[model samples]
Target: MGQQTVNEPPVVEGPATQEFAPEVEKLINTVAKFTVLVSQKLPDDVAARLKELAEEETAPMAKMIYSTMARNQDLAWQLKRPSCQDTGLVQLFVRAGTDFPYLDRVDAAMKEAVARATKWSPLRLNTVETFDEYNTGTNTGSRSPWIYWQTIPDSDSLELDVYLAGGGCSLPGQGKTLMPGEGYEAAVKFVLDVMTSYGINACPPLLVGVGIGSSIDAAAYMSKAALMRPVGSHSANPKAAELETELKDAIDRIGLGPQGLGGQHSVMGVNIENSARHPSVLSVAVNTGCWSHRRGTIRIASDLSYELLTHKGVEL
Candidate 1:
């Protein structure tokens, strides 16, 4: 899948596409292409981890499911289509250098890129307005193609972390707050409970992201953000890293297996991201990425030259 290539350049041709300057237009084209790539191809890390998990399975049923997954990816690459039917609602986590020239245009360009990708990659129309109850049909609506922004000091590049949050994976997402006295064990229990009750629905062998903070909102954001990290990555803090390993072991012991059919392992890995909480309260949230966790990262220089960090050897 990594070696698969699309030679034809993606062209964005709406009334809005011509509004951008040459530089911003190039940015839009590059981002649009990368968005398509992210939907169709698993990142190198995810692909490698899937192979590792498949090797560890001893059950014939689990083994067969893994083989099916491998074939699914091959077909996705060969057909030049999304690996999963739910291409998911696009989410971009942007780290823009303070000096980056196109920062002002980044937001609009990102929306344009997603709109273009919807037609080109043929992404499913996943954006629906609340209460209004209608699909936007462009994979975009009010505040759709969600963007989370950060500022980078003394740099001249924009780094984009792309994620496809599908409905099945999003269904299990939850958050909770515990009094100081509850301690961290309660947080651990919260994670285990969520997994055992809802994990299978997301298709087992999940990539779990846990976030600890003082409020549900903060923890929820961090939890989803944690999914942007590569599978098998550990937190920099030693204790947090230990928690990752512990939770991974505990969840694997659940034996949900591939596609939740029951087998040797329940998760690809567990990742924890935390922020110092208020002394009075502790909040923890959980987010899961299904076996086909579609995510990627790209770095674009001020000149618009780019690097596909997560998908090495693949070009936009």
Candidate 2:
């Protein structure tokens, strides 16, 4: 949440004053360890979705592929290793109250976590300079391992949505701004266009995120953010939920299946996140998340009590 926030909600500071300075360092170290744990383990929600999708698939080859995906996940857990060879990119979506004692340390905590995770989880060396093309090896660099933040007013907890943005899925991301006359129909058409044009390579069944807002960048950011949400959770708005259902159905009909092999369902789910739009412009963006769909959410309370929402019963 570097600075993609639209307009931050009002936050009232709590007891995180000068007396808590020592606690800040501890919190950073805690977050760093949590990052390593997240990197190597597949979240339960993703595993459940894969199981559900596998059951729905009727094609022999597709079913076999899903079985293999499940086996890979099993082996990763059994061996306590990364599920994929290309760990891809790390992106953390954070929600924290301004009053949290460790607020100042959040950014550093995240960076330190990424660096530590590279060696601990043994993550792939994904950060390279833009033009120079030299690997940083540690996955920490200028704007690398991006973190998105949203502040929750009157709260004293840090909630993190950690995601491994695999390169295969990110390759198909695209955004566009439709003119006033284009209407919502045009937005759906654009999503369909993206799926047909590029979804196969990303390794379906995909979790499709569709973002609609006032501008391309805004929508693009939301689209990526949407992926961080729980896989099957839809927007609260009825219209938005309907759009999500329609998009999921339509995209699944594309039959990209597991690893792009033809089958009954192409996508596991389609999630739409939207905000008020400028009357003259309807900006939309689409992001695909592959079957692995590695994302997890963890929350740490002011009292230091912790919970892993996506991975139940996890102490960290």
Candidate 3:
């Protein structure tokens, strides 16, 4: 990210602004623009990884598909439209500092931002009520634009990992509890089984996220969070990093290639995030991001200055 300072004057001019209404409006606009940006352009790491995969692909048909994907992205940028028709269900992974002045307002601001983005980006209406089963049309519904939060201690910044969880990629996500006796090897097996069975449906080369933890819910959350990491990054834990490499190599060997038609690679990379679990319990979850990997990270400082950590040389 370029870390450029926003030069626009504050949306409101006043000294008695304790409510921070001006800041909220600015945040809403910034997030709305970011939503659109990610829809049209892949993150820097994802874009680079795709190019690498395209070069490594040797199958004639797969290579052609890769070229088509490249052209699709180019057209998306040129036309300033969504690269994929399913712009996806909006999700924000929030890491908000406890000291952040606007903590209480973040939720409303983000929801409003999504509403604005829906119209501005012309985002596909993907939110539907569960069970009741009706599309909201506005891309907002009960519990839609799901926001996952983590509070930071003794800090004053807000960071967000925004993701467009498309239906294809969402279809392959799975989590299950394994007996401790089955061991980590079983976890590996679970990942392989899921990908081998459903990877094609996700539109490879995928960015596979694996989470191991004490409970299914924890594992599922971590699995999705892992997708927010840069494409080729590895876990800090040596064992986890090794698992990542092993899984990545195994998935690549599957030969799903571009659009899963068949070729040399099935995934951009594998990321493993783990949490210590009760001795009796082992839970593992797998989540995948399709090749487009529509996601971005932004860090906003106390004064509301921001950095787009994933898309360098870009501004909202």
Off by over 4 Å in 3: 1-20
Candidate 1: TM-score? Answer: 0.94
- Give the per-residue lDDT of model 3 (tens digit) for 28-70: 7888899999999999999999999889878999999999999
Candidate 1, overall lDDT?
A: 0.91
Q: TM-scores of all models? A: 0.94, 0.90, 0.92
Residue range with the least summed lDDT across 10 consecutive positions in model 3: 9-18
Stronger candidate by TM-score (1 vs 3)? 1
Off by over 4 Å in 2: 1-22
Q: What is the lDDT of residue 281 in candidate 2?
A: 94
Rank ordering of all candidates by lDDT, starting from the highest: 1, 3, 2
All candidates' lDDT scores? 0.91, 0.82, 0.90
Error of 3 at 304 (Å): 2.0
User: Whose lDDT is higher: candidate 1's or candidate 2's?
Assistant: 1
Q: Which candidate is the best by TM-score?
A: 1
